[model samples]
Target: MPALRNIRMLTRYTAWANERLFSALGELPAGEPLAARATGSGNMVRTLNHAYVVDRIWQAHLQGQPHGFTSRNTEDTPTLDALRIDQARIDAWYIEYADALTAEGHDEVVVFQFVDGGAGAMTRGDMLLHVVNHKTFHRGYVADMIYQVPARPPSMDLPVFLRDTVPRLT
Candidate 1:
């Protein structure tokens, strides 16, 4: 069950880090996130929408349903406030799902199709890990976009999440 504990901690960390990023995003000048940027996803809001869309896709995979997403990001990005709300809700769902997973459940295999129309299979735990790790990677892109605004992004390091939000899993 130690793996289960670690999974729960990771899911919690993912949520904590995302919340910090969203908090920093709130300080951006109006329309700044939507401004053109020379980076991944082209802008802050679109980058975030990419993360959100991916999360939703994985959630649908975990639930054995269709995600209805044809791409990694939507054609239109939501406002920061709206994306924040959606992210919080999905983050909470992952946390609760991770908490409820038993060791056997964590190891269960999930068969899914990638957005590229490729076949894929991963353990439940691996999928969850992907969800967290993938978000962290894109958040790095968002952090870079934040700097384009000549502003500081919030520190969402795992150690910070551990010390300030959830303790390390023993």
Candidate 2:
């Protein structure tokens, strides 16, 4: 049950960190997010989009609903503003999801199909942790891309989030 508190903190932190990253990305020079990068996702926007897609997939899994995502990311990249809006909505959804969870519910296993059609199963708490970690990992990718743009990325480290945001690093 104590794990529920950690999950709630982590999900909220994820949202805060995401907002910081989006704010920094939004301030980049014109066309920076779409600028071609050597990464498999092609560009910063696309990489972030990949994270968004996964978030939705896991959300559907938790809700026992079909996500309808055929791929990890869409073929087209959304404008930074549009993606920011979408990410904010999903981030809030995650916060609410965590808040509403009971300890037993958090530990309940949810089975679902992956985007690649592979069958999968994970506990609700584990799924939330995965979602948090996945976004952080891709944010690192985006941070790297941000540096490649010869710009400074927002300081998105967990310590920063803890110190400047909410729910102290405890």
Candidate 3:
């Protein structure tokens, strides 16, 4: 029960952070330095694109739709506006899915093929946690990329999300 509660909190916090990041991304001028290759392997735009693609892949899995990403090396970057729109839509889905979930839902196991075409199954809870953790990891990379840019990067931390958006909860 505590784990479920924790997951619920994390899911909420992730939604909050996603909104903030997407909003900040919208403010970025086009053609601005997206990422610092010296600091990380992928540029800011590329890392964000990766996150977006992964989100879509997992979302497709969750929705029982056909997934779009087949390889990790594939390059996919829609315009910033397009990515921002999709991010907002997916974040909303995550929030709604988290809210509507019951304990029984978390226990249900879903089978799916990985991006690499490997077959696997995971509990709804594990998959949900994976989505949150996956976003957090890549968001950190995006934040790092933003730091290398001329514009100030938004605070994407969970604590920051709590303090800034859900102050009443704490």
Candidate 4:
């Protein structure tokens, strides 16, 4: 299925980009991710955590289960090491899900409740895209925060992913 392949490619790209981002984050000076910023999430780690939370929420939706999240973010800001491990687990799940999804599965509509208690629905493929896009969006915020530290963030462009992670793609 072409659609399943696209979702698989996107999930893999997201995982690769996330790995790059975490590697860059690990290189930041101590406390940089935790340092207070003017952003809504207050700091880089919090922003990243929100993305993780949303990923899990979508994962639950895809599984037709309750996500058990009352908000978009958690109260605790996870340490970089812990967050990396958690994110990696979820990333692996997404990749496996995409790899195993059927041709017709991609177009199946999943009804879900948003964190704000709003009713929502999306096709499985669209939800996967949303998850990847959501991570990219917040990764931008973290990249900006990294810039504020007078540091460089790893280039996470999709072309970079294609060049570095999947050069075999025709």
Task: Please identify which of the two predictions, 1 or 2, would achieve the higher TM-score against the true structure.
Answer: 2
What is residue 34's positional error in candidate 3, in angstroms? 4.0
Model 4, runs deviating above 4 Å: none
Instruction: For candidate 2, write residues 25-140 as lDDT tens digits.
Output: 88999999999999989999999999999999899999999999999999888888999999999999999999999999998988999888899999999999999999999999
lDDT of 2: 0.92
Best by lDDT: 4
List candidate 1 segments past 4 Å from native.
Answer: 167-170
RMSD of candidate 2 to true structure, Å: 1.6
Question: Candidate 3 lDDT, tens digit per residue, 1-170?
Answer: 76677678888887777767777766777665353465443566566667767777877777778886676534555666777777778877877887777898878888888988998888888888998998889888666666666567778788786677664843
Task: Give the alpha-carbon lDDT of every model.
Answer: 0.92, 0.92, 0.74, 0.93
RMSD of each: 1.7, 1.6, 2.6, 1.1
Residue 46 C-alpha lDDT in model 2: 95
For candidate 4, write residues 1-170 as lDDT tens digits.
77887889999999999999999999999999899998989999999999999999999999999999998999888898999999999999999999988878899899999989989999999999999999999999999999999899999999888887775845
Candidate with the larger TM-score of 2 and 3: 2
Ranking by lDDT: 4, 2, 1, 3
Residue-wise lDDT of candidate 1 within 1-170, one digit each (tens)?
Answer: 88898989999999999998998888888888889999878888888889999999999999999998899999887988999999999999999999999899999999999999999999999999999999999999989889989899999898887788754587
